[model samples]
Target: MPTGLALRDPRQQLFDAAERVLVRDGPTGLTSRAVTTEAGVAKGVLHRYFADFDAFLTGLVLDRIARVKAQATALGETAGTGTVADNLTSALMTSFDPVMVSIVALIIARDELRTRLRTAGTARFPLVGEGSAMIAGYLTAERELGRIAPDADIDTVAPTLIGAAHLLFTERKDSPPEPEAVRKVVTTVLAGAMR
Candidate 1:
């Protein structure tokens, strides 16, 4: 008799496999059978956990959003304890993965993932609002410390700054910007907006 593969819980195995496949191959590669094979489970395991390919895709997108939110959460919790520039820099830097950013930008450029995100409504996703708020929180701390002007509207400035950073860094595949240069953009816009 042939030896069998070691068994693990189906749902855990599916999610773990899906995560690996997504990280390595991204959205288009997340097929049910592929995930099951990666986990050494039967093909039917994916269907048992997720209703369909669409359902699995949705879960994967949401999981990615949750991970970004967790990073933003950690940044938010630490925002007040550091220098304003340092805190904001840390928060923005966490979201800028050159490889994944390029992949997502290409996917959106082809109108593949963008259509889904539009239909899903970007605001409903945790990462957007959570990231914006985290930035705003840091700006507010800056204002309190008089590092920014007294009349800064953190609510508007924060989202605008985050949007600008995302636009510049997340959608391009040219030579990447330097860390110090990126930090300058953050500090300059933040100061200008506050001033």
Candidate 2:
């Protein structure tokens, strides 16, 4: 164990290291050993903090969910402030950034991890589900502000927009799409809803 690790937040260190492993090696490559090694902490450190590898993964996924929720809150507050497409474009980039997109891939690849997340009552599909909800909330607020069609079905629009954004982002996992590319998808998906 590094003497310095005791002074820092081990859980956060592990989570960040796990994130790097997932992005670098993909989900199949995410092992307890990999995380500990990447973190430069002793293997025992992970076990000491978490019950098992599943527990550690659960903690990491939950931490990511919380981050998405924070982004959602920030986006929700922006209702009516900017063009709807512009707000959604920015939110999509933050919501589906590289790490987040990798986390989504991880959730899809690991049945055990997905089961653990569901058992813990994290969002149904984690990032994707939460991302949809985030867009839904923002679209709802815009509807109330009369920036969108009064009859716009925000529920449908939200998921459609998120799904489209997710596709665009995942298409090139090495780099995020240009903001203009995201904005194009946002505008296309929300065309029916926007005023």
In order, candidate lDDTs are 0.64, 0.88
- How do the residues 53-117 of candidate 2 rate in per-residue lDDT, one tens digit apiece? 98898899899889889998999899989789899999988788778888888889888989999
What is the C-alpha local distance difference test score of candidate 2?
A: 0.88
Weakest ten-residue segment in model 1 by summed lDDT = 102-111
Give the distance in Å from residue 140's predicted Cα in candidate 1 to where it truly belongs: 3.6
Residue-level lDDT of model 1, residues 95-166, one tens digit each, is 765533533433444354445655775544334555677677666665776667888778888888777777
TM-score for all models, in order of appearance = 0.67, 0.95
* Pairs that clash in candidate 1: none
Angstrom error at residue 43, model 1: 3.1
Residue pairs in steric clash, candidate 2? none
Model 1 TM-score? 0.67
Q: Please state every model's RMSD to the true fold in angstroms.
A: 4.5, 1.3
